[model samples]
Target: MIKDIPEDKRNTFAAIGLLTVCWASAEYALDFIIRCVHERYGGSQIREAPPVSFKGKPPYLREAFANHPDLAGYLPQLNEFLEEAWQIAEQRHWCIHGSIDLRADASTFPISKIIHGKEHRQDTREFTARQIELLAGRASALSVNLIFFGIQTVRLMPKEEANKLLRELLRKYSAALPEDGPF
Candidate 1:
């Protein structure tokens, strides 16, 4: 399908691909942070230190919450959603990246690792199929958002305005999906 796309459309496709990569990467990192937080905070009587390490300032997640202080107001629920989204993003990334090993059979990789942590433990084939489905859905959603964002950016919209639009789009899209648990 990508090969069949016209030259002009190719650039659009490429932009979408880049945005998807960015989104996936962000999702992965956020999930990692959320897992760290949960393992530190959830259930144990001892107050564990925050799992995130910092160079100068606190971790990005903390900083993000701080900068958008309202996020801290709903910390528990927000962190839960963030963790869920992160897990889906992590699985999607793994499936996409693992498929790159063209010479090896799928069985050579640990099939158990793919679906072990999910609430519903699907078989390897089902897991892979679901991941592919998610990827396709995410790509379509991201592409539409990217097109609109690009148009707004090119129109010389204020940075804050553009960021607000992007954030709202992502929030809506993420809210529409099923929660997948922390990575």
Candidate 2:
């Protein structure tokens, strides 16, 4: 079916693919931050950290970092990244989940989905290749920024405090771990 698309419509598909992949990269970056937060917050291992969905991650990390004084300087950037990341997630949801019109041009690519409620309605939105590309760029930037934030957070933590936290975490999870290891 993809092969049947006309040449003019291929750019839309490509743009959509870019957005999808970029957003995935952003998610991976967020996971890195999750791992850092889990370790910093006395999580023995990532597996021991409670499960959190993508939608819940930003708020959880924001609150966690806000409680620590060392992370104060980075809060502004963290808040900005989290806010933008949330916005991007919303756009990503629509673009990835909505149905596209194959006959539409790249400049007026239409994506629509049915909204279910007391009375159902169709929600349709148009996106140009340029707009999708811009979103992809933002997603890519967010991924890079998240990685830097995690790295900085790790570096800023005092060695003694980190060690103490790790020790406590290991102790908490020790009883459940096998003799060989958590594996």
Candidate 3:
């Protein structure tokens, strides 16, 4: 059955699948951090886990962290990750939702999205398989870094333990973590 499919379609499918897995990993990590922060500091009156979703995820994270003043120190790093993650999210959105147009040479395909919001907006971009692969790699790294960020939070550990684990994570994944990432 796979052999019957066109090469471009097959490649597109594979890329999408890889990106989805990477994105899901990052999303799950973000959710884990949010839930931990909420439960640890939300107090007995707040019994429910904080809401986490693709839409407004950055804001949701900001609000969750803000609710607990102690996490203020991590805010800058979290903001940086959120900015990068949001860019990746946009590319992922276009890949998944935009109309696909294969170039004549088939070296690259253009994805177009039309926004019918307050102001009409048209977005079209060409993507190569290599570009998609790079995006996937970034998403994967973001997931790992997010998990590290979470370990540093949760206050379950003493200050020393939290910093110790963070240092170990950074040292272990030195290449994977972005240079700008908090050490």
Candidate 4:
């Protein structure tokens, strides 16, 4: 029967919502990158389900690049970008994993984690509105950059190079594709 939550609690709730949106958008970007690679090289064999792990994406992209020499020289740069993205992902995880408790006089959410059956309040963090907004903005911007990176990688290749395997892949899966709409 929690009622009469203070204004600070309201902001805390909003911050949680914003962080949720941030993480989801970032995750979507990670998947979109892999999907682009599959479409260009992996053919119909690629899984429709999202990747099993977030950390696995960079390696998968590296492998994708290795398989296609034309996409070379991009892996190092991609790795650098991905490392930055991973740091954000780590922060997102920390926020998501922590429990936000609202106190009557506080200005923001106090985040705490439970360890060894005890709530370790000593390590708790107070997440301010600005911090939340910054995280969300970073996530949103990163997602856009990720999409652009994928597009740029594909476009940088020669037209024939880009679609070299795609044509054959489509032919291979032509039978699987239904005549009406997507199969």
lDDT of 4: 0.67
lDDT of 2: 0.74
lDDT of each: 0.42, 0.74, 0.76, 0.67
Question: Judged by TM-score relative to the true structure, which candidate is superior, 1 or 2?
Answer: 2
Scored by lDDT, the top model is 3
How many clashes show up per model? Answer: 0, 0, 0, 0
Q: Model 4 — TM-score against the truth? A: 0.66
RMSD values for the candidates in order, in angstroms, are 13.3, 11.6, 5.5, 10.7
Q: After superposition, how far is residue 125 of candidate 1 from its true place, in Å?
A: 7.0
> Between 2 and 3, whose TM-score is larger?
3
lDDT by residue for model 3 over 1-183, one digit each (tens)?
889867876787688779989999998988777666666766323435466457756876776666668887778898998998999998999998888875445868888999789989988888877788889999999998887777766643455655565667668876343443343
In model 4, which range of ten residues has the least summed lDDT? 174-183
Can you write out model 1's per-residue Cα lDDT over 21-125, one digit (the tens) per residue? 755554444444444433432311222333332221124444444344334554554454445444545555555433332232332232323355547554442
Ranking by lDDT: 3, 2, 4, 1
- In model 3, the runs with Cα more than 4 Å from the true position are 43-49, 120-122, 155-183
Best by TM-score: 3
* Candidate 4 off by > 4 Å: 1-3, 42-50, 114-123, 155-183
The full ranking of all candidates by TM-score, starting with the best, is: 3, 2, 4, 1
RMSD of 2: 11.6
Task: List pairs with backbone clashes in candidate 4.
Answer: none
TM-score of each: 0.32, 0.73, 0.75, 0.66
